[model samples]
Structures are given as structure tokens and as C-alpha cells.
Target chain A: MREAKKQPGIAEVAAAAGVSVTTVSHVLSGRRPVSAATRALVETVIKELGYRPNPSARGLRTQRSESIALIVPDLTNPFYTLVAAGLQDVLMESGYLLSITDAAQPGRALPEVVRHVLARRVDGIVLASYGATDDDIASIAETGTKLVRLGSRFRADFGDVVRADDVGGMHDVVDHLLARGYRRIGLVNGEYDAQPSQMRLEGYTRALREAGRTADPDLIHFGTFSRAGGAAGARRLFDSAHPPDAIVGGNDLIAVGVMDAARERGLAIPRDVAITGYDDIEAASLVTPALTTVHNPAREIGRTCARMLLDRLAGKYDDVAREVVLAHRLVIRESS
Target chain B: MREAKKQPGIAEVAAAAGVSVTTVSHVLSGRRPVSAATRALVETVIKELGYRPNPSARGLRTQRSESIALIVPDLTNPFYTLVAAGLQDVLMESGYLLSITDAAQPGRALPEVVRHVLARRVDGIVLASYGATDDDIASIAETGTKLVRLGSRFRADFGDVVRADDVGGMHDVVDHLLARGYRRIGLVNGEYDAQPSQMRLEGYTRALREAGRTADPDLIHFGTFSRAGGAAGARRLFDSAHPPDAIVGGNDLIAVGVMDAARERGLAIPRDVAITGYDDIEAASLVTPALTTVHNPAREIGRTCARMLLDRLAGKYDDVAREVVLAHRLVIRESS
Candidate 1:
């Protein structure tokens, strides 16, 4: 193997071609569509820079296991499983097998899981981490292992990020509820420290302000992402001297719990307390007075992560971290 | 490495020790509890029979990538995910990372998925196969890889079987519904070829016979396991000349769809019509009038599969295939 420091890299080739590194990558990998003229220029630059695309690296790639590992916080959560489904569908088509492991299991934290996956020498890794530190990610990259971060737990600069627009999704949710003439709306969010929860809170506040209603801190309650958490938040709001006319769950599971709490108190859904949730999980529609919620594109996000990781493995680009934000939609059902 | 043809294996040692192969295995692995006296006798017999456990085999075991792969029909289903969760919890405690793959994805048939998993040389495989054939089982076994068959898709003689009691569970559901004085019960099952569907249908028939009522052919409907299938089946039963007084779903998803069908017809649950379902998944309780369903121990079944597979990998037993059937119970909620 030639010394990497002396060998010209893809960056040099891109610079000589006067095109983005990504364009140069696309020209090499042929993974994405590129203009014919741009492709020709990039091919010429590659030969001029003596950027021999690492013959030894190509040899190693041939011996590659052609398997990808996905580490998720909760395997039982439908959102994560749906993501796994999408990821598997795409990877399977390209002759790559996807191995999904869980991070929430005892003694199998994110760092520990990463070590085991790295030890297996998978071609790449997709991590849906909530508390992964910089060191955790750096360790994987340092090994020349392609990596893609799922969700908004880390900044875009950290690595390739594939996630839904949490802020915009939540903003749409609140605006929809307010438009229905529901005053004193309460938000029951997941743990406050989690980036998704924080972003959702920001969306709720912005929507409230845009509607000429001052955001009430008293109406905000944060808890775990389970039904128990949502129920606890709903109870707190219900017990307050001034309960909100509507309650919004951070996710479907929490929203289901809020409904449970309301029912326990003999409160009829929609008639007594309008309810809404995020992540239009099957349970949302299964519940009576089916929940009005945001349809977070979890499956699409998973597919995007697989594509991004595949691109990296194909030697597409080694530039700064890239990000892909999927779209979200409001699914209005009977609850509102 | 010594030639295996000239060496005494675990079976020979067990025969000379006058003990069961499993007992000798237990003494060797120390994974399960065994008496000290039995352990001493087994060790002594090993020395007398010149039965040297292959050192090369031991070295290979040491070099094994401590990871297991799980292949399920559908990754998006909560039942499989819950099982994966249970499997992960037990495997993690033993320092084993589990990689889950889906067989239902396009271009990723069961055999193809198995080939990829085998190519990666996983320590063991846990397959929740629906249509796997004898060739599939023989191929995995021929590789000298540890295997555990999840679900009732295959017979116990084929390999290690870990599954819930589908027949007994469905029987209990029927008995409960009968006790509630609901006559003219119709069953909507999954595909006719599936072992679970067959077993469940048998249970439903046996219950009807014991109650001195014959199962009407028109009352039996077969469809896919999704919500649309359930709803379609329910609609058929509803439009029949003699609509069933109650409907039973093969699984919870189908039951939710049955609920949808009833709602579309403006029928009040348990009043104008009664409903029941199998697999008391999260959606069972989340749905209105909660679901009267069988509580399938999917997670426990998953845990059992992991333990069984680990025992095999530990060289505990290589005799005839083993089987473990977990228990199931009927959960009578309001929907009944």
C-alpha cells in the first residue's frame, strides 16, 4: 500500500476539476446522477492528479463482509423497527445484509455495542444514538469505518445525519390544534435533555407566539418517552388549577398514555379533552377517536441512512458531514 | 489438528460414562446446574476413554466472533421486535451482540438471507421462518453452525424449536368467548398454509365441537396478517346472510382491522357485535373497548430461543433436536 500522505486524495482531484468533492465522488462511484460534461472533467482531473484510487483499498473492499450494522436505542419501539425495515429493504437490494442491534439492553450501551460491531469488521455502521458522545463516533471513523448517524442526537458536522424535520413537524402539530379553536393547549414532551424533545418544544413555542398567544411555561411537562410518562404529564396538567383544553403528546406512545389517564378520570376523548400525538404509529389510529398526529417519516429516514452509508462505502465523498432532512405531514383524525 | 475420525467425541464419552449426552455436556460447559458427583464421574470417564476434546476446536471457539444473527419474516411487526428485544437482553448479558435481518424484504428471500448470514460466519442463527424448507435447515446445520428455529414453522425433529402454544391459546380464547354466551363466532385467520394458522383453526374447531356446535365453513375466512386482511374478512362475515354475532382475528393487527370494519357498519362493540384477537400486542389494549385476546409470550419465546442457541454453541448438546414451548394465557378485556 502506498503512503496515504504522499498519494493525492479525492479532494485534490475535485479541486483540479473545479467541481465539488461530491460531484467528483459521484463521477467515481456513479451512484447519483451527474451532468455528462462534469463527469468528463472529473475523470480527466483524476488521471492528472495521479489519484490512483487506492488499489490496495480496492483489494480490501473485495474481501469486505458486505454487511452493515444498525444500533438503535429501543428495538421494540415501532419507529425504530420501521426504520430497520426501510434500511433492510434498500441494503438487501444492493446485496448488503443489515444487522440491527439494540443499545437499550442492559450491559449493551451505545459505546459497548459500537465496540462489538467494530470488532466484527462490518463495512459500515448506522447508529440511532440518543446519548452518543464525540469519542464514540470518532472511534468508529478512526478505524476507516463508514458511519451515518440517525436522528438529531448529534450535529450535522459530526457525520452523515438522516432524520425528519422534528421542529417543523411539531410546529405544524401545534398550529393545527390552535386552528381548531383549542385554547390553553398543553404539551407533554419526552425527556427535556434529548435533542428531539428540545426541538419539539421550540416548535411549540414558536407556533404559540405566531398565533399571538404567549407560551405558558406552566403547561409544559417533560417525562420519559413511555405511556407512564405521558400519563404522568397529563395528570399534572389535569390537576392544575387551570387545565388546558387540549393536550399534545411528544410521541404516539406518550399520547396513548395521555388517553389512558384521561379515561381513568372519566374524561371523554375530544368531547372533554382534545388529544394529539406525534409519530402516527399504528396505535394512534387504533385508539378510539383516533389521534390527530404528525406522520414522522421514520421508514424513509432509515432508507436515507442506508443510502448515505452506501455512498460513503463506494468512496463517493470524504468531505464534511452531510445531512438529509425528510419531510413530515400532519394526519388529522377524529381526536381534534 | 488431530483427525476427528480417530478421536472420541462427546457422545462416546457420555456412553462410556453411562450418563446422558446432555449431562456430560452440562459438566463440560457448566452453563446449567449439575451435581458434583455426576460431574466427577463424567470427568473421570473422559480421561479413561482417551476422549480428548479437540484443542483446535477449542481454539476456533475462542476465535469466534461472539455475535448471533436473527432472521424474521417481518421486521416492522411489533411481535417480532418484542421477541428481538427479549433475545437481545439475554444475549447482551452474555456479551453477545445480536444482528437482526428481515426475510420479507424484496430480493431478500429466506434462503438468500440465510446465505448472507452464513457467509458472515455468525456463531449461531435464530430463524423465525414462515416458509423455510428442509433444504434451508440442512444447509445451516451442514455448516456446523448452531441453529434454533423460532415459531412453529418447522417441526421439533428438524432442530431446536422455540414457540408459544398457538393451539392452546386459541382454544382458550374460544372457550372464553363461549362462556360469555356468544354464539355464531367467526374466525379470520392468516394464510391457510401457515402452521400457526392451522393450529389456531384446529383449536377453534375443537372448542366448537366440545360445545356441541359445528364450525360453519362460511364462518372461516383466511387472509394475510395485516389490518386490511382482517377488515376484508370481517366485511365478508358481516355481509353474509347470517352475520356472525362475534368475530375473532388471527392476530391483534387483524383484530384492529375487524374493529374498523364494525365501525364502518355503525355497529357498537359488544352490543351489536363482539370481537376477539390473538397476540395481545400493544395495539390490542390501545384500541377502543380494549381487545379480548391471547397474551402470546413473544419476548419470552425470544429469550428461550437465545438460551437454546447458546447452549448449542457452548457444546452442551448435539444429540436430537430440542424443543421449548412457552406458555400463553387469555387476556379478557372489554372488547369480548
Candidate 2:
């Protein structure tokens, strides 16, 4: 029994049950009809022998890879991972697997990624952070593959988009900073060409205009959406002849960099130069003085995106040109 | 022409070529032979239609699912995402799709997860940051699936294991802290049974003993491997009458919590209370008083695990069972 158990294969089960491999597969999957006597014998043999069909073999008939793709702008950032967790949760429940791709590499490889996902024939695709160009988005829309964009907004006439209210969220942060008596506010922005960066910069400028404060071009520094970029930006801000009293970074990593820059210059947070960040990642709460930042709903965005894609795949939504904007919150900690 | 280019279906390609769907499929996939003239005509029509095979349709083949599974403890941690990125880098090159699952939820649902992965028939499985019990591991091994463990060392009669030098790495951290003149050191550990936690604890004790210092039971606290747990453990350490002058956490998240605890108590790091952490995640560098921690080779570990699994699948190294232990480094920062 032990020897037989050690080498339990489909052939052993088929032979034991007096059936062929095809017959066994037909009985197991019920893709075709089989005699009750033969079915019962196969079932008994399968149960007794602990016979399991190779997954690779069974996958051939379903025409469903049962997998999806998750493309994020960066993996080093904790925010995307949290979003990934949420997406994985929902997709796993529906028996779909997720493949993750980083979009922040050189050239931002979205086109190649799209081709790979298509080649693998994934059930759907989730764009976690990359903003799709018109051409790419249009192609995806035409391909009839379900797509959900996370933390990004696009004009493409395809797929549902899940985004946080960056404008409103930034407004809250600016208002709170003002209420806290931070007058000379500086903005550490990301690349101006990116949609989120543009929206955030606009929000900053709009808030300053509303508050009767001139938006100083010198106060704004543009860099990559990263901690080093934030650090460098902070250095530039500090080097300026007229340093702002408070700095608002494009995202939390930049905020952390600004904090590092402040500490390097012997400046204290909130006491000497207040700082704030966006995307309220896990690091926001873990950083010293904790970080006063805008809470972008990363996980919620991911879950909503996955659910939206699943809905689209299941024909729950007929219109592909739908947008779902999620809400973001402003969390004030010691930095402000 | 533009409208025709917008929708490329197999039927359109077949109709354009005046061939049956089966003939077109056979011609395109090379499953069976067709006349040269018909094949050439079908190819031209396929190109004209811009027809791409639906991955869902191709997935129905039994021999190759072209999908893989990545199981991790949590994605909220940046380390796992980094590892995921490395795994994706390799798997993507081979045209395999990936699905990720978080096993941190209560009860972990390992059996269900196994069944799901089996049903999908992933070409292989990668286990990261999580470990399976003997029975569960044995069951998976019995199924003849190619399995690889990342950042974990477990020997089963079947499957491969990959791990980092946890004991040696912890010793490096402890020695560094000791060299920095930190005595009366405390240890903040994860759940007692976790593999890394147990190994780290052993190294901590061994280091203290080697330094001719008696181990203080009161200085050790076990908590969840999270920031909250670290915070709680730090509070316990400080609230005690004999608060240690230094603290070592099992991981970076716990160390971040300890840093918070020190700030709340007004203890100056590296002066009043030096702290060290393990797993040099991004936050370890970004946090205030940048964390001095052990740098586990996360990406290397992930890449090595993938290679090991691929080698097993390819029938390489059949005669010998082997283990690969990667090296780790201690990154010194402001915290200690």
C-alpha cells in the first residue's frame, strides 16, 4: 500500500478503475457524460488512491488561465504593496491569481507589459499606478480585456478607473496647515507632466490663491516621486534665500526625505520647519513625530479596481467608459 | 480600415481567409497541418485582422497553464514587494503569469489556498515570508508539485527550501550594537514560533553569552511582527523598573515602534536608548534617526528561490538535496 501510494498517478487510478485516462478526465470534470458504473468505480479508485489530476493538465480544457495582472509604478513604496494586498484578497476569493509588474523601470514599460499580459491571456489587468497614454488605453479598450486603473485618472474610453480625490484631499491638508498657523508654505512637487502631479500642484496653487497668498515659483521644487527626490528638493528649498516655514511634499516618500534634510540641517519638525506629505503610507505613521500627510485610499482603490474589473468581466457593467473616484482623508500628525 | 482594425476577432480572421475556425486555429497554433496555400492566406488575414489569441482560450490546454503562485505573509511590508518584483522580473522573462496570495489572514486558510492553486494548476509555487506545518507541507509535497520556500528553511522529503543566514545576521546586529557601547540591551521579538523569530532569539542569547553578559529574561518580549506589536513591546520594556539602555527588534517594523516609544518617553536615541532592527526595509532608512538594522538579501533570496524551483521543474540536481543560505549585512544608521 505504501509503495502504491508513493507512485499514485493518473494511469494507476485509470487501471485500478478499468477506465481510460480520457474517461477518467471526463468523469472528474463532467465535461462529457460517462456511465454511472464507470463513474462510481473511478470515484472510488480516486478517493482510495488519493489521486489528483495535475493542474497543468486540467487547465487545458477550461480556456481560463484564472490569472490577472497587477501593474504598479513602484514596488519599493509600501503604498503599492498595500494596494496589491487588497487586490489579491478580492481576486483570490474569486479563484483568480494575480501577476504583479513594476512600471517604474526605465522607459516605464507599459506597452511591453500590455503585450505580455495579452500573451499570457490573463482574465483582466489592474493598473495600480501608471497613467495610460491615449494610444495604449485605446488599444486596451479595443482588446475587450477588463482593466481597472488604481490611483490614476485617464481620459481613455476604456475600463473603469479607481482614484482618490487628490484635489479635495490636498485642500484639506492645506486648510489644516493654514489653521495650524503655517504661513510661509512650500510645495515639493513631482514631475509636472504626470496627471496626479499636475492635479496636486494645481491644488496647492489653488489653495494658496484662495488664502490670498501668492504662489511663489521658488517655493516649488520638482523631482521624482521618491524619497531621494524629496530629500534633494528639501535641500533646494533650504538653500533658497527665503525658506518657507512649512513644506508640503508630493507624496510620503518625499516628505520623509524633507524630514531627513531638515534633520541634517539641525532643523526640528513642526518647531523649526513644519512638513507634510501625501499618500499617508504605513511609513507616515511610523516616522518620528509621525508624518502629517494626506491619506490616499490605496487598499480601497485596489479593492475597488479589482471589483470593478471583475464586474466588467462578469458583464455587470455594459459601459466601459465609467469612472469610480474613491475618497481620501487628511491625517494630521506632529509634522504639521 | 480603422474600424476593422479596432475589433480583431478569430472569426473575423477566419472569415477574411475563407477558412473554418478549426483550420485557422490549427494553422495559427500549428496544432495540425494545413495546405500551404490555405496557411499563407490565413496568416495574411490574421495579420490584417491583427488577431491576438485570447489567453483565456489558450489556457484550456492541459499540459501547460503558464501560471505561477506567490504566497507571502503580508504585502503591507515593503520587503515582500521587493521580493515580488524580483520574482516577477524572472518569471516575466519566461512568459509565465503570477498570482500572489497573502497568508496573514486569521487561520491562514492554507488548505483552501493549496486547493485553489492546484485547481488553477500553477506551473510552480513560491512561498515567501510564510511557512507551512509539517503535515500541510507534506501534503503539498505528495502532490508532486514543484515548491520553493523563500526566506524560510524547511526540509521535506520533497520540495526545495531557501533561507537567509538569520542567526549570523542577528549576531552582526547584536555585535554592532554592543560595539556602540550599548549595554542592558532588550530584545523585541515576534511570535515565539515564527522561524526567523526563534533563530533571531537564539542569536541574541548567544551573542549576550559570548559577550560574557548574562541573559535577562525580563529584557525579552514577544509580540506580533508589526509596528503595533513593537510599540507594545517597547512600552513594556520602558515601563519596567529595570528598563534596558538598548533595544533590538526582530524586524524593522518592530524597531520603528520602539523608536516611537522612545520618542514618547523623551529618550534620545544612541544617547539614552540605542535601538536596532532587522530587515532593512525602505522605512528603516526613511524614519527619523534612520534605523540601524540587518539587511536581509531580499531580492537575491527571491531570485534564488525562483531559480531553484525552475531547476527542479527542469530535472536538474536530481541526485542530491541541497540548501542555499544567502548572506546578510548590518547597515548602520543614526538610530544606534
Candidate 3:
């Protein structure tokens, strides 16, 4: 059995790190910023000292690894970053070590995520994949391992899913646009193979129909879920003879792309045309006109996902799969 | 001792996932966007099938775990995000699993990082901390583990070090400020204990001396490396009886904070007050009036750090500590 070497005091760690006992304590206490080198040194010393917290507690849960893996699509997205923060908070509270990875990285095959989970022999997995499939899900559930899916092609029977009401959120954005007197609204969407985009598109059409508005096929464009892709789609829409009075991008990055194209064409937002985005990331408020966007409640989703997984791992929800649907809100800002 | 389970064929995984062979293969190949649920389903099945990559290769490296861990301070910062990407790219090429963690999480004691490093038994570590010390570096060095320090306190003997020429970069920014005829220059810096801030302060003083300008005590402020902190620092400078016409922010986040305060005060950038930031993060270009800042070569630093660690692990540089100093560039944008 791989047992912890021995108990080591904090003073020893500090001395090993070559910092004062106070500095070591501060670094471990999360009270202040220790120099980077000092922080690293302390990390090494802790490992060297085999400083395991509470052996009795660890011994009781020797059956449990106290580790989980979270596979997200991309780290560049602030929305995902928020999810990571929220997830970490919950997991840390549960005394679980969270291992985060990206599904979008090259060679990051969906199977590799499984391979890692198995290799690490983690207790659970949370997948906020850009895209995953039915068969892929069945594989995870078949093992009886605790798992939760965040905003993907999930059916209730597939597994426990924690997602935002993107469909309703999009409807709210369209309604807000209509109420603001923008009739010809446009939607530049990406990730056609993903659930968020499909749901968003549904809401867009549903809202337009409810308002008794005519739908112009020309107003809709498709592109990748990125700034450049959004810009490309917007450029196409703007170049068309009849453009939209307002455009709601699939996400914030896409919306930023539209804003980029607008700037290039000298088109003023809310004057020549208005623009909105999904996922009210940190950058949304910092942009020139401050993009009006829908709050996807990523942090809540993360919390819900982590909580649900921990519950299952603890045998709290052993009888059936669990599900949670987080709410979304349309935030009215300068752009719209 | 534990050994990898028997290798499962792709066909078995497909059947277990309840997907067609073609779909399972496609999911693994990354040729198309497989739905998220399916991706999850497939991952579960792969694990259920006790999947292993290959036997001979796995056996050959059974004694040599190809896992490397990276400990960064904050995930909210885009600079660290880029570093993660760069490090992942190289580590992946070397057939090593890169495990990333943040050293700044609340209750994330310094020991926990080391504990994780030891638990995973990673072959090496890369520490991208804001601040670190000599003792810390020496301790990590004594472990006989390959280590690389990214952007922190350093000495010629502090293991292997990879850092930006922050002092020179700061000098360039100061010279730029002087060239724009701003006599009363201020600096709102964060992470007083970190190398970046100290180097930037040094650069500020050096440029002023070269330009025959005396440094004023009233023109300097210190705060945490955060936007709110930056804003607070800037508010102080602005409230001062003799406010500077120009100011330099320790990093982009700080600069943005300063810009926020200036905006609230109705001070037009480059008109009423010129502001600049360090670490030209992604948001620097997206923010209103863009930003003038130093381009901290984060990705290059990450690559360098990872490469050096891998080299050490492979016995490429067994005797002496290696060092690499990445260059920094000043990017002039509208904010300045």
C-alpha cells in the first residue's frame, strides 16, 4: 500500500523553503502573495515532507480517491473560466482534487478524456465538452461512475445534466430587441453541432414567430464560435443589401467579432445597427459600447454539476440519474 | 504493483457505447463535431471496456511516468492561460500528460501543490508564480526533480529560470511616456513582492534618470495585482493635488482598472490622461481605445520552461542549471 511517508510540521516546510516561518505560514494560509519562487520551493518542501492532512480522515476514506476530473472545451473562454472557478470552489469544499482539461486541444480526443479518467482512476468526471455524442455518454454511464454533463447533446436518460435555459434566454434577447423596436434581427451562430447553438437558434425563431414578425433567411448566418468567425458572418450580413437592425451573436466572442466588422465598416452600434451577445463574460462590459448579453449562469451550472457528482459519489442519489437546469437572464447594456 | 488493464478494441468500445463503429472512430479521430452527449457516452464506454493505448509502449514506460505538472498562480489572468496553452503544446509533443493547477486557490496550502506533485509522481514541475524566493528554488532543486521557475524572484543559482526582461520593458514604457511629453508620470503597480513589479519600478526609475527627470514620491502607488486594486491606486493618484498627466500600470488588469477610474472621472485617454499597462493580454486589444502596454512573452516563456524541464528529465542538461530570458516588446495603442 502507498502510505503517506510521515507527518511534517509547517516550520520544517518553511525552513526547507528558505523563507521565514511566517512567510511559509502566509503562503499556505492564502493570506498574502509569497514570491513565486518561494511558493514553488514551499510546494517542493511539502512534498518532500509528506505533509498529509489528517491521517484518520484519509484512512477512513481510503476507499475514495478524493479526486475528480473536469473536461472543458477551451480555457480562453471567460465563461469556461468562470465555470472552473465555480467548480473548484465546490470541489474544494467537498475535499476533492479537481483536474481540469480542455476538449478542444489538438489530440484531445473524446476517448482520451476517458483514458485519463480510467488511468487516474478518478471517482467522477464532469464534461463540459464542446461536443460529445450519445454513444459516448452511454460508455460513461455503463460503468456506474458518477458523471455530469454541462450544456451538451444530452437527453435526460443519457445522464445527469446541468445546463442553462439557452433556448429561453435567446427568446428573452429577441423579445428585448423587439421591444426596443428592432424588427429585422439577425443571429450569427457557431458550433452547429452543439446544443447551445441549436437551442439559441430555436429561441430566435420562436421569439420572432411569437412576435408575428417575418423571418428573413438572409438575416441568419453561420460561422465558428470565434471572433474572426463572428466577424466573417457579420461581414457577410452587412454586405447584403438589407442588413439587420440588431444582431445577437451566438456567444460573446462571436459578438466581439461582429463588433470588429462594424468598426471596420465605420458602422456605429445602436445607431446604424445594434449588437448583443450570449455569455456575459468579463470582456462584455469592457468593450467600447459594452455589449448587452445573456447571463448563462455558468458558475451556478458548475456548482450544480460538482454538487450532483459528489452526491452520487457519496451514494446520496444512488437510485436514479439527477438533473439541474440553471436559469439565464438578458442583461440590457449599451450595445442594444 | 498496479498494472494497466487489458487493451480493449475500438469495436468493443463502440458496441458498449451503443454507437456504430464509424461514429466511435469519428469521435476518436476528431474529424467532425460529435455531439456532446455522444462524446460523454463514448468516453464512459471506453473506460468501461478497460481501454489501454498499447502494451509494449506502456510496458516500456511503466517505470517512467510521462506526467508533468504546472503550478500557476491565477487562472483568471489571460497571460497564464496562454502559458498553459504553450506548455500543453510542447508537453503533448513529448508524449507527456501535463497536469495544471493553481497555487492561489483559497485553502490551497503550498503543501497541497507538493502533495499533488508527489501523489501523481510527476517527473517534473513548472512554477509560474507571481512571487517566489531563493530558498524555495533551492529546495525544489534539491529534490532531484527537473524544475523550471517562470516569472518570479531569481538568482544565477536558482535552479533553471525562464523570465521576461521586465526591467528593460518598463524602461521602454517610461521612455515612450517621456517622448509623449509627460513630465509628471505616475505608476500604479501590483505584486510588490513579484519580479514584474520590481523590474517595472526599476525601469521607471532608470528611464526618468536617463531623461533628466527626477522621480517623485507622490507619483508612485502600490496595490494588489487586480483591477479593483489598480482602480483604487489610480483613484489615489487622481485625487492627489498634483496628478500625473500619464501613468503606467503594473499589468494589463491594473491598467484597465486605471482606465476604469479615468473613464468614471470623464478623463479621455491620451487626452486628459495617458495610461499604459504591462502584459498586453487579449483584452488590451478589445477594450475601448485599446491599450498601450508591454507584450510579456507568456507563451514563449511557457514553451521555454517546459522544454527545459523535459530536457533535464531526459538528462540533456544534468550538471548545470539552464536559463532562458525571453524578450518583451512595447505595443503602442490608443489608450496611451
Backbone N/Cα/C clashes per model: 0, 11, 31
Ranking by DockQ: 2, 1, 3
> What local lDDT does model 2 show for residue A16?
91
TM-score for every candidate vs. truth? 0.80, 0.85, 0.80
Q: Candidate 3: what lDDT? A: 0.78
Candidate 2 docking class: acceptable
For each candidate, C-alpha RMSD in Å? 13.7, 5.2, 10.7
Instruction: Say which prediction, candidate 1 or candidate 2, comes out ahead on TM-score.
Output: 2
Candidate 1 regions exceeding 4 Å error are: A1-65, A153-157, B1-65, B153-157
The weakest ten consecutive residues by lDDT in model 2 chain A span A1-10
Ranking by lDDT: 1, 2, 3
lDDT of 2 by residue, A42-127 (tens): 99999998776654334435544556788877877877887887887788788777778887666438887777787666667887
lDDT of 3 by residue, A2-94 (tens): 112334556677777777877876766678988888888887887777653432233223534466777777877878877877787677656
lDDT of 1 by residue, B115-186 (tens): 777655567899887777878877677656778887665454567888788888989989988898899999
Best prediction by lDDT:
1
Candidate 1 global Cα RMSD? 13.7
Misplaced by over 4 Å in model 2 are A1-63, A106-108, A154-156, B1-62, B129-131, B156-158, B239-241
- The TM-score of the first chain in every model comes to 0.79, 0.83, 0.81
Best by DockQ: 2
